[model samples]
Target: MNREPNAQLIAVMDEAQVSNKGLAKRLRDAAEQRGMNLGTSHVGVQRWRDGAGIKPETAALMAEVLSTKLNRRITPSDLGFFSQLTPATPPAPPSVGYPSTVSDALSALNGLAEEPPKGPDAGRLIVPDAELSSAVLSWMISRPDGVQADQPASQRVGMRDVHAIRAAAETFMQLDFKFGGGHGHKALRYYFRYEVLPLLNATFSEQVGTALFGAASEISQLLAWSAYDSGNHRLAHQYLTSTLRLSQVTDDRMFGARILSNLSHQANYLGNHAQAINLARAAIEGAKGKATPRAMSMYSAMEARALSNIGDHKGAGRAMNEAERYFERAESSSDPEWLSYFDSAELMGEFCHCFRDLKQRRESVQYAQRAVDDTDPRYVRTLGFCRMVLAQSQLLNGEVEAAVATAGLAVEGGESLQSSRFQRYVTDFQAEVSAYASNPAAAAFNEQVRDALARLDDE
Candidate 1:
């Protein structure tokens, strides 16, 4: 029972006069446009044309390439990659458009909330890597959405609704820090769908409307962060990008810079250091003297991370020194509440990470231990993550026994959390311990982690 050839895809490719290699190149370019780096060679393209299934992320991009060529949307199903997997959520309407207008941005986000949740529950990283070159340029050039003095009433929006939105954002931030993003992401979706969506339609004075947008943007950023923690990178990117746009709409320079910083951080994690550096720099530029020093410091620290990874130690050092200087002059009370988490403990973690990348084990351990000691239990996922860095620093310093204990503490603290970042910490710790597998203590730690990871995977 041989299946039919991919005549649809082949015919489209023929009409577009696109070779396998050309399509692969276009897909990679599309990914880069969204600050992502995907590897799909011509060989993979040939396989796709031979009727082999492609990764869903790649499939979406391939469709985009064809869509651009043919001036028509082409979905994966049309290309013959359809599977029996249950639909996650109905796709947003095509007319929703980019995050250009307040109406466009809100409609897009609300539509996402309306989509049904997916099964196997593993979230996809962000997608539809549409060209944001325009988005970035506009952030630098356009006036922020000016004050709206009034809107027609679905219901008179009140101070109470604004308060509720702020409170929910704060609560969700706490939950994500303590329990990881996956802990209560559903609450976010529910809050957006049931609570915030209605308010967007509610009547409000200009001041109240501004406040509502600010509060809702905060919640949206939290949703983005949680989605990233849950290993749904694409969703995280989409949410973060839109939140950044929302920040612009609200004219909150500090918040928009912070959102860009998060996007920069994600790019670094995904091994796209060049893109990370570009995003961090863009944040600083977009802030245009409006960013608080603390916000500047956070963005600079992110740049330092990317610069160091890109083999620019001198540049990394200069940027890091700039961060420390700015942070010292920071008036925390004057800062937005969103920057609260970027305190001393978080800075120390960044310092430790910098030295670790440079292979300065002793210096790294000193700062890493400080981060672990300073980490509050309320920041459960961060505490677990810092412990892993300390453990690795100890391992690199030839303190194998202590490393095991530190790594064990991290495993205990983060085992139940669904954070890709914390999971990476565990993974890196195991790789270090593998060298000492012949040692009994190391073997025990490995077994402990094995069981913990099993539970995580099962979840």
Candidate 2:
């Protein structure tokens, strides 16, 4: 079919300062980075520039490549290809690609804030395996660029501003723990995008700049966690990758390692157990002497969780033992404030998960009780999850009445939060209790859970 030349595509390529061959190479690498293989070359890029139609997925990838390269949001429509998409072709998912630099990361963050990706996994670039692995490896060996903010933007900043950002992050974090991600996700994004992101470009002393980037990393990780809890895995991963980029600029190895552990946790949740284990191990390796005992313990616990999920019981147990040992050595004073949430209650919760997955009913019950009993009242979501695990363990041991009572409590507690993860936990528990549907207690517990979930959906 004859078509008009894509003048818009040519203009953007020129604006991005990339030749046709360079754009082709970048598109190829972008696909490869995400565990996808694309055979496009300069010829194809030229064809697109000449108004040849492109596939929806390729169009999305091309937009992402130009977006990061130019450090701004770019869509296929910006390249004059909107009408080329036929009715049978689904609209391409938006681009949330891995960023190549700190500036690119900031731009990507702004894009996410202005328009959060819709649906379950719409804008994800990195899959659990190759792309994720590549991102983690790049973060590990990366060196910091010294004396950041030497060339500042128009605004001036100081340590006071940095502290304010940190304070706001702490407040948002507490809200997330108490009321779930849905309560604070939008507000947190607005705060970070408007209140904090601009500071990254402002003039400050090296000391203040380091503190500012560190604070930004913390908030970014919190954003990732909030997104994960809200069932927006694509947004979560993008936030985390951006967090890693920010942490690198601060030259804070331990903080970056913590971010890696967060990625590992999410990877496990998304069913990429092997990748999760690798990421946890990468965190440990990268942190080395930089991580305090508590941080080390948390990474090991993440590894144990993944191992258990993959049926590597012996490996999981060894990792769990190591986690406990390192945790025993932890000093409260030496631990970073960002890691304060991983106390004994949290460790016991990890143990409960590992044991539960391993089908050790007795051990799971013991740890689950400790996790639930020791959790602070402020940690409502954590408490509900611990109770759910305890209930599941009790059912496994044939304590039907006790299990039903505990599950009912879990359902009641879960009603107060807006976390999809918590709802999933409740659903999983209900599925387990289905075999005992003939039992009156189990039947009532299932009904209670269904009602609770229905209420959540309405809200």
Candidate 3:
């Protein structure tokens, strides 16, 4: 069969200044790096360029190589591998109408329950900055209304049901903090789909309805966080949006602000620095009077993170100062039960992140030390993340030995946790430490990380 020449592949290969021979070599090298042995040559590259069909797995591997070389995400479709792209771009999520009212919010949540899983393999579905901004604006301008049973279903719900949900949500949150989001993720989803969704439709008084919605919102927000941690961005977005709608119905402005803060954190993680900044600011603005100082401090710290990410040193400094001031004013007694986790240790971790991004290695290391030292041992994921930050800071400070030691601890701490985000941190540190692999200690650490990651992949 005659095939069309792969102009797109040829163009990108040229842009990367890679000859067919070079690409073939790099492909083999990349596969070797992944512990896979794939044979390839200039002949294979020529065939691909001539539009001969490529295996989807090989195309995905090629996309990964190009993405790493270009320092940006390059899907297989971008390289004219349309067959490989099919799995990445799934069908659109089910629509349940716009979330303008409490009923509408419930509809959205129900639709989300039926939506197909966009697991790790599916490419991210990014919300544009304009759309994100518009959502924030809508949430800000919207006023909460009293909730009541519009049309009750067979099941009866009350304060007991709400309490049960809150209890279950706390358990899942604890599991998430310790074992990472993938742990208990399926149980949480099952609970939401089977147990939680029915309560939303059950008969309840106005007061019970209000509290029930609040519980629903909390669980949905937790779902969003779990999805984000698992690298399922599309599902996370849906759960977050639905949470915001439910929060509106529950009249919990502060809770809504926290959801926005979650969005900021996700945006920053995805490299949408500008949008992250905007989302953080919106959280601060939207919860002005309702938010406790602890909550405000967390929001401001998120802003600082985004600012530092965008290289706005002065802006980040100001935001950091604001965050510190808010923390100083924060009293645990006055804060909500949910915001309890944003303690001093977490705050220090935030500072560590911002300072690291700003290249303030000394400050970053100091804050990271405090964060790691003060964090509870049970919060394994937090420890893993903070240790990675400390490792990066130490490496930048020219303390190669110390950096290697710290990164080794991070890898060990991450062993029990099943978070892809945490793995990415380890992966990044591996890349950074590769420069020092000539050092005996750094070489050992590199091998350790490689083994750990390989084990993860096998499981």
CA deviation > 4 Å runs, candidate 3: 1-98, 121-125, 149-153, 457-459
Residue pairs that clash (backbone atoms under 3 angstroms), model 3: none
The digit string of per-residue lDDT tens for model 1 on 239-358 reads: 776777787776888788788788888877655566788888888787758988888888999998888655576888898998899899889888877788888899988988777665
lDDT of residue 191 for candidate 1? 87
* Candidate numbers, best TM-score first, in rank order: 3, 2, 1
The lowest-lDDT stretch of 10 consecutive residues in candidate 2 is 84-93
User: Model 3 over residues 1-459: C-alpha lDDT tens digits?
Assistant: 877778678977986788999889988987787566779899999999998887645675686577557644344555766533224343354231237777777677677676736456233345666667667888888777667675657878879888999999999999999988888777887888889988877788888998888887888888888887887777777778878877887678899989989988987876667789999999999989998999999999999999987667899999999999999999989987788888899999999998887778789999999999999888889989999999988976889899999999989878878887897677556655554545799779878877887887787
lDDT of 1 at 112: 67
Candidate 2 per-residue C-alpha lDDT over 193-261 given as tens digits, one digit per residue, 9 for 90 to 100: 899988888888888888888888888889889988887877888888888877778778889888889
Evaluated with lDDT, which candidate comes out highest? Answer: 2
* lDDT sort, best first: 2, 3, 1
Say which candidate scores most in TM-score: 3
lDDT of candidate model 1 versus the reference = 0.75
Winner of 2 and 3 under lDDT: 2
TM-score of the candidate numbered 1? 0.76
